[model samples]
Target: MILTGSRLEVMHFVGEKVEGYMKEFLKPVETYWQPADLLPDPTQENFLEEVKLLRESARELSYDYMAVLIGDTITEEALPTYESWLMEVEGVNQADYDQGWSKWVRAWTAEENRHGDLLNKFLYLSGRVNMRAMEQSTQYLISDGFDIGTGRDPYRNFVYTSFQELATNISHRRTATLAKQAGCPQLSKICGVIASDEMRHAKAYSAFIREVFAVDPSEMMLAFEDMMRKKIVMPAHFLRETGTKIGETFSHFSDAAQRLGVYTTIDYIEIMESLLNEWQIETVTDLNDAGQRARDYLVALPARLRRIADRTRIPTLEYPFSWIA
Candidate 1:
C-alpha cells in the first residue's frame, strides 16, 4: 500500500504504534544479550592470534569470491555506497542512541569486507573471473542503490536488519553448498563459518524486535503489518550493480524457486513464528481493541504465507537456491 497521506499524519499514527509496542514490550524486555565467556580460550594473546588468523582467512576467501562474483576489479565500489547509507540512517538520528548501532554496522562491514577480499584473492589465486557476465551483473546492480526511507524509523531499520541478516546467512550457506559440490572443502569451511556469524546477526535483530513487540504489542503488531505490506529489501540491492537482474532473480525465485530454498516464504513465516513464540507475544496481557485486531491480523500471517507458497507451486528442491527455475 502507498503511504499517500501527509507526513505528519503518517508519523503520528506510526509513532503511537511505536510507543505502544515499546511501552508494552521493549521496556519490559530491556535486557541485552551478553555472553559470559570472553573468547574460545579466554587467554588474551591466544585470543588475539586466533582472531587475527580468522580475519586473515576471511579476508582471503572474501576477496576470492568477490572477484569471481563481480569480476576481477576489487575497486570497493559498493563499500562506499553501503557506508554512506549507514551514515544516513543512523537509528533515530541521535548520536548517543546510535553508538551501538554504529558499532554493529562497522563491525559487520569490516567482516563483510573481508568476504570480498578473500573471494577476490581466491579468484586471483585460482583464475575464476567470468569477466563479461560478472561485469554486466555488477553494472546493473550498482545503477540502482538500495532505498531506505528518510523517516529514520528505528523499527523499520530493525526489520530491515532482521531479514537482511537471515538472507545473508542463506546466501552464505548456499554458496558453501555450491563450493562443496565443486570439490573445494576450504571454501566450504570458510563460508560455513561466515554463515554461523550471519545466523547470530539475524538472532540479534529478531530478539530485539521481540522485545519491541513486548513493549507495545498493539503498536508492534500494527508496525509489523505496515512493514509486511511495504516489503523489505536487502542492503546490497542498490550496490550490487545488478538491481534489475537482482529483482528478476527474486521474481524468478518467487515464481519458480521459493519452495526450493531455505529462504522460502514458509521458512520466513516459521522464523517469525518461532520468534513470537519465544517472546510470548500472544500471552501479553491487557491488549486494547486495536491490539486485539492486530493480534488477529498476525494470526493469519502464517496461513497467508503458506497459501501464497502453495499457489505459486514452486518446486521444493532439497538444497537452498538450487532450484533450476
Candidate 2:
C-alpha cells in the first residue's frame, strides 16, 4: 500500500534523527565484542582441548534445546533478507546510501552478523548439530524470504521490529538461562551477549516509534494496531529443510521451542503487552475516531491473547528435527 502523505512526512522526520539513535542504541566497532572473543581460537595450542570440552558439554544439551538453538541460528543467519526488507521501507531506501537510516541499517547489520557467526561456530565445535542440514535450512530461509505484513510503511515496520527485537531478546535470554542450567557456561555467555544486543536494538526501534507517535500519534496508533491485528510473524516461519516444502520445518521447530520453553505463545502475549505499556497506547490522545478505536483494540489485545494462551496447549510429542545430529 502506498504511504499517506502524513506517514511519508513522519518517516522522513524520524529518519533525520537516525544518527542520534545510532549512537545511543549501538556500540562502537572497536569496543564491541567479536565472535572470535567467545569461541576457541584455532591459533591457540589449547584449542583442541577446549573443543573437546565444548563437544562434551554440547552432548549434555537436550534434543529440544538443540533444535531451538539451530532454528534461532538459522533465523539470525538470514540477515540478508531482513536488511533488504528494511532497506526497502518507505524512507529508508538503501539506494540512497547517504541517508542516516541506511547508515543505521548497515551498522545494525554489522552487530547482528556476529550472532549467527558465534552460534554456528559454537555448534560446529560442539559437534552436536547436523551442519549440512542446518546450512541448507538457513539458505532456504534467506531465499524464500517472508511476508510479515509490514509492507514498506516505516510506522508498521518499526512496530514490527520493536516487537520482534524484544521477542528475540526473551528467547535468547531464556536460552542463556537454560544453557547455564545445562552446564554450558560458554554457550550461556554467548546467548547472554547476543540477547543484550537485541534489547538495545529493541530500545532503538521503540524509540523510533515513540518519535513518530509524538508527531503522528493517530497514524502511529493505527499502524501499531494494524500490526497487532495481523500478528507479528517470526522470520523463521519461512524455514524449510532438505526435500521439504516451505514452512514445514517451522512447525517442528516451533514445537521444539514450545516444548523447551525457549519461546512460547505466552511469551508472544507478554511481548505485545510490554509494547503496549511501553508505548503508552491508552494514553495516546488527539486521535481520530478510527485511531481511537485502534488504540482501544490494542490496549485490550493482551488480555484477549492471554485468554487464548491459557486455553491453548503445547504438544507433548516432539517432532524430530533434521538439524539435530
Top candidate, metric TM-score: 2
Which clashing pairs does model 2 show? Answer: none
Query: Which residue runs of candidate 2 sit more than 4 Å off their true CA positions?
Result: 1-4
Give lDDT tens digits, candidate 1, residues 16-105. 444333333221213422121212244565765654443444343332233223321222335555655665552422254434445445
Q: Write the per-residue lDDT of candidate 2 for residues 1-325, one digit (tens) a residue.
A: 2234666677787788989999899999898899999989999999999999999888889989999999999999999999999898887878888889899999999899999999999999898888999999998899899999999889899998999999999999999999999999999999999999999999999999888888888888989988988999997898899999999989888888898888999999989888888998889877889999999898888888888888988988888788888
**C-alpha displacement of 205 in model 2, angstroms?**
0.2
- Evaluated at residue 118, the lDDT of candidate 2 is 94
How many residue pairs collide in each prediction? 41, 0
TM-score of each: 0.61, 0.97
